[model samples]
Target: MGNINKRGSKDLVVDSDQSQQDSPTITVDNQLCDAIIKEDCSTIKALLRSHPVNQPLTILTSYRLLFEQQTCTVIPIHLAAEYCKPRSLLCLLEHGADPEVRDTQGHTTLHLMLLHWPIVSSTWTKPGNRIQRLMADIQNNAVSCLHILFQHGAQVNAQVGNSNKYSPLHLAITYGTHPILSLLAQNGAQVNAVNESSMTPLHMAADILNENMIKTLIACGANVNCVIPHNGNTALKLAVCTASSKAGQLLSAGVGCIRLLLIHGAHVNAQDHEGQTALHEACCGGREAIINLLLEFEANVNILTKNGESAIYMYLQRSSNIRDLMVLTRLLYCSYPLRLTNRQGVLPAGIMLPEFQLLKETLVRLARKPLPLEDICKKNIRNIYGKKYKYYVRQLLPGKLWNSIYNCYDLADVLKGDL
Candidate 1:
C-alpha cells in the first residue's frame, strides 16, 4: 500500500514498500530560509528579484524549500508570525504575500502568530531578567506583526483552524495573546463571533477562567448572555462546568470569572440544552464557594434540569465524600426544595449512600420544619435588599445569631461521629 499525503490542493504519494535509501529526497534552498530566519530584508528582496517570474516563487516557496518532509503546508508569513519576526512579516506583506493565506490546518498568519507565541517562565531568578526582556521584545514584535497584517487588510473576523473555526479573537484569548485581543477588538474583530460549536469568544475565555480576557470581551460589547446555539450554554454555564479545578481546589479566578459575568448581566439561571443552570453546574463541581456564590446571585437551587434533576439532586448524586456533605448541607441550608424528583422519579434522599444516613435524616427534618420567625425576617430582608446587601446584613448581625438564622450549622460534629 502507498501512503498518501494531502498538501493544499495537491496530494503526494510515498511507497511504503520502498526502503529508506530507495526513497527520493526533496531539497529546499537553505539560504532563503536562513535569510527569512535572520530577517534580512535586503537578502530576501534580492532572492525574490533573482527568481524568474515564470517560477511564481513566494515565501511559501521558501518554506517548502526548508521543510519538504512536512506534510502540513505552511506559508512564509505564517513562519514569520510564529517566530515573532515582525520585520520579515512586514517585508513579506510589502512584497505582496497574502496575510490571509491559510496553512494546511486553515490557520492564517494572524492565527499562527498568537497560537505559537513564546512561553515565558514565571520563575524569577538570575537568568529570568534576560528571558523576561526577550519575552517583552517578542510580545512587542508580535503586536507589531498583528498591526501590520490588519493594516494590510487581513480578515479580522475570519475563522481559523479547520476543526475549531475559531475567529482570530478566539485564538488571541485561547493562547493568552492579551495585547492582541484588545487590538483585534479595536481593529473591528467581531467580539461576539461564534465558532463551529456556536460558542462565542467569551465562552472560550470563561472556559479558561481568564477574568481579564472576559472583562476585555465584555467591555468590547461581547454579549454576556450569548448562548451556544446547539447546547444553549451561556458563558456563565461554561464557567461553572469547565472550571479548571474540583471542589476545595476550585480556582478563585474561576469563581471571580463567574461572579464578574453575573455582575455584567450574564443570566445566572440561564439553562443549557438540558435545562441546567449555573447552579446545577456548581453542584456538579461540588465546590462550596462556587455553590455559595451562585446562591448569593439568586441561582435557583430548586430549578430542575431537563432530566428533572435539581441542584440538590446533582450535589447528592455527584458528591464523592463527606467533605462534599457540607456542600450538600449548605444547599439544604439554602432551602433547596426537598420533595422534587428527577426524571427517573428518584428524590434526592433516595440517592443517599448508607454512610450519609444521618445527613439525610437531618435534611429531611429541616425540610419538614417551618422557617423560624427570625430566619423568615432575614430571608425577606435578603430578598428585598438583594444579594449584595446580604453580606452587609451578615456583618451587622452577631456571628452566632446570623449563623443560627441562616441555618449555617456545622456538619463537622456529624462527620466526627463516623470518625
Candidate 2:
C-alpha cells in the first residue's frame, strides 16, 4: 500500500510534515507568563535582567498572561491602582506593556482603575483626615490615566460587550462620574452613544437616577428621543418605565430636556417601531408627573401599540395604588370616552373588567339626575349615591370640573342634536 490510498474515484494524498508546520505556536513564553501572573516582582525583575533587551512581544505576552489569569493579588496592577505598587506598573510601562490594554472584558486599565480605586482606598479612612483628600487622589489619577490612554490612541468609545453594550461614557454615567463623562465627551466620546441594547448615556443616567447626569447629557446634545436600535425606545420612555422615587428625580431633570427636544422638533406623538408612544411609557411606569408632562407636549392619547394596547390600557394595567388609579381615571376621562376602543376594538370599560364596572357605576351616578317626574325622588337619589359621587368629584376636580360642566351645559343647545 502506498502512503496515499486510492479513494472511490481518485487517489488521496496526505502531507504530515505540512500539517504539523501549519499548526499555530503558543508564541508566548510560559515562565515569564507565570511570573507576571503571580506578580512575583523578584521573578519578573530577574527575567528582565536575564533578557537584557526589551521586546514588545515578550512584554505583551507576559502582561496578557497575568491579566488573562487575574492573578492581581500578586500582580498588584491587577489589583486596584491604589493597592498596586506604582513601581511595578511603571516597570511594566517601561518594558513596553501597553498601559491601555483591556482585559478579556474590554475594560481597559483605566476602567479597572476607576472602579477599583475607590475599593482599595476604602480601607484607608482616617478620622481626622478629610475623606475628600483620599478620593481626590484617585479621581485625579483616574483623570491622568484616561489622558494617557487618549494620548496613546486608545478607543474612546469602545463598548463593554455585554447586556449594556455600554461604552466608557455609559460607565461614567452609570457610576455618576460626571467629570469623567465630561473628559470623555471633550475627547470625542459620543454623548448620545448607545450600548448594545441601544441605550444612550442619558438612558444610563436615568437607570441610575442621576439627575445631574441627565442634565449634563442633555446639555451635551444627547437626543432626547434617540430610540434604542433593538426596540425603538427613547430615553424618556426608559425613564417613565422606572417608577422609583429616584426615577421621579431623573424625570424632573429630564423635564427640561423633554421641553428642549420638543422645541427642537421631537415628535410628540411619534411611536416606536412597536407603535408605542412616550405616553405609553409614562402611563405604564405609573408616573403621573411624567404623564402630565407628556400631555403638555401634546402626546397623542389615542395612539395604540401594535398589540392594540393604548396608554390608558397600560396605565390601568400598571395602576397599583388608589392614587395611581385615580390619576389615570381622570386622564382617561379627559381623553377619549371610556367607550373609545383600541385597534382590537376593546373599549376601556371592556378591558378593565371589574375595575371598569366599578368605575362605570360611579360615572353613571355622577352623571345622573332625578327624572322630571318628582323632586323628592331626585333628592332621595342625591341623598344616596349622588352626594358621595359629587364629593369624590369635588375632591378630584375642585373648581375645574364644575367650570367644565357649566361650559358643557351652556353648549348643550348645539350638542342636543348629537345627543
Candidate 3:
C-alpha cells in the first residue's frame, strides 16, 4: 500500500511539472495581444521577436450574435490602430503587417482608427485643461498612426463591408478634424462617394451643421447639389430642416452651414420630396436668420409646396413665439405673396398677429398693388443672372457703395464678401 501511494504521488508531481511547462506557450500569444491592446510597446516588440517574423499575430475575438457564433480574427496592426497606439502600430507596420489587411468584419487598419474618432472629437466638451491636452495627444497619435499606414500603401477609399458600406472618407466626416479630412482627401479618397443611403460626405456635414467640414468638402470637389435618394433632400434643404430642430438651435451652426452651401452654389430653390424648399423649412421652424439668409440668396418667395401651402402660410400656421413674427416681417420684406391661399384656403392676412391689426389694412392694400417699374427691372436682372447676380452687381457698382444702394438685391455679408 505504501509503494502504491508513492507511485501515485510521483505521477501527480510529473503532471504538475508538465502543466507548468505548457502554460507559457499556451498564453504567450494572448499575452502579446493584451500587451498590444494595452499599448505596451516594449513588451509588444519583445513578444513579436519570439514569433516567426513571417507569421503575423492574430486576435481571435469571440462573441455571440443572436444564435450564431461571430468570431472575429484581427491582426496586431488593427488592434494597435483600434486602441490609437501610434508607436505600436508603427512597430507592427515595420515588422511587415500589411496595412490593407481586413478583419473578418471587413475593418481595415484605417477603419479601426476611425472607429475611435467620435470619442476623441467629443473630448473637447469635457471640462479640464489636462483632459484637453490628453485628448489632443490621443488625436495626434491616431493621426500619426494613419500617416504611417498611408505610408505603407493603405487604401484611402476602402469601404467597410458592413451593411452601410461606408468608405473611409464617410467615416472621417462623421467626427473628423480638418487635418484628418485633408489627409484622406489628399490620399485620393473620393470626396463625393455616397453610402448605402446615397448620402455623400457633404450630406453628413450639412446634417450635423459642420460649417468647416462643408467648406473643406466643397474645396475637395463635393457636389453642392447632390440629393439624397431616400428623401430627395439636398444638403441645403437637410441643413435647414436639421437646424430647425432643438439640436440645431443649440449648435447655432445652421445659418453658417446654409450660408456656406449657398455661397458654393447650392440651388436656393431646390425642393425635397415633400416639395418644401429650405425657405419653407425655415418658416415652419420659425428660424429668423435662416429666413433672411435664404431671401438674400434669391430663394423664391413665391414658391409653393406640393401641398399648395406657400412658405408664408407655413410660417403663420406654426408660428410659436412673438419672435417668430420677426421672421414673418422678413418674409413680407422679401415679397412673399400674401394672396397665395394655403391648403386651408386661408390668406396670410387671415392669421395676422393682434399687434399687426393697426397695419392690417395697409398690408392688404400693399399686396394688391403691383410691383413698380424700378422693382420690376431689378427683379428681371436678378432672375436673368440667377447665381451670377451678385458677381455682375459687384462689377457694375465696384465698391461698398453697391451694397448700400442695392440693399434690395444684396446678398448676406457672408456671401457678399465673396462677391
Top of the candidates by TM-score: 1
Better of 1 and 2 by lDDT: 1
lDDT tens readout by residue for model 3, 41-64:
788788877864334453333332
Question: Candidate 1 versus the native: TM-score?
Answer: 0.77
lDDT of 2 by residue, 53-143 (tens): 2332222111333433211111223332323234445555555555455555556655555444332233444423555565555455555
What is the alpha-carbon lDDT for the whole of candidate 1?
A: 0.68
Which regions in candidate 1 have their CA more than 4 angstroms from the true location? 1-28, 52-74, 121-128, 244-253, 319-329, 349-351, 365-387, 391-419
Higher-ranked by TM-score: 1 or 3: 1
Ranking by lDDT: 3, 1, 2
**lDDT agreement with native, every candidate:** 0.68, 0.52, 0.69
Q: Clash pairs of candidate 3?
A: none
Residues 1-419 of candidate 1 have per-residue lDDT tens digits of: 11111112222223233223331221122334446668998887776564421222122221334544333334556666777788888887788788777766787877777676554443433334554676756666767887888899988898976888989888888765455678999999999998888888898999878788898889889899988888888898888876625632544548788889989998888898898898887777677778778878777666788888887777766536335556665565454335445788675643476766766666556557677676667555544444556668788899877665554445445544532
Q: What is the C-alpha RMSD of each candidate to the true structure, in Å?
A: 7.2, 15.0, 12.0
> Lowest summed lDDT over 10 consecutive residues: which window, candidate 1?
1-10
Q: After superposition, how far is residue 149 of candidate 2 from its true place, in Å?
A: 2.8
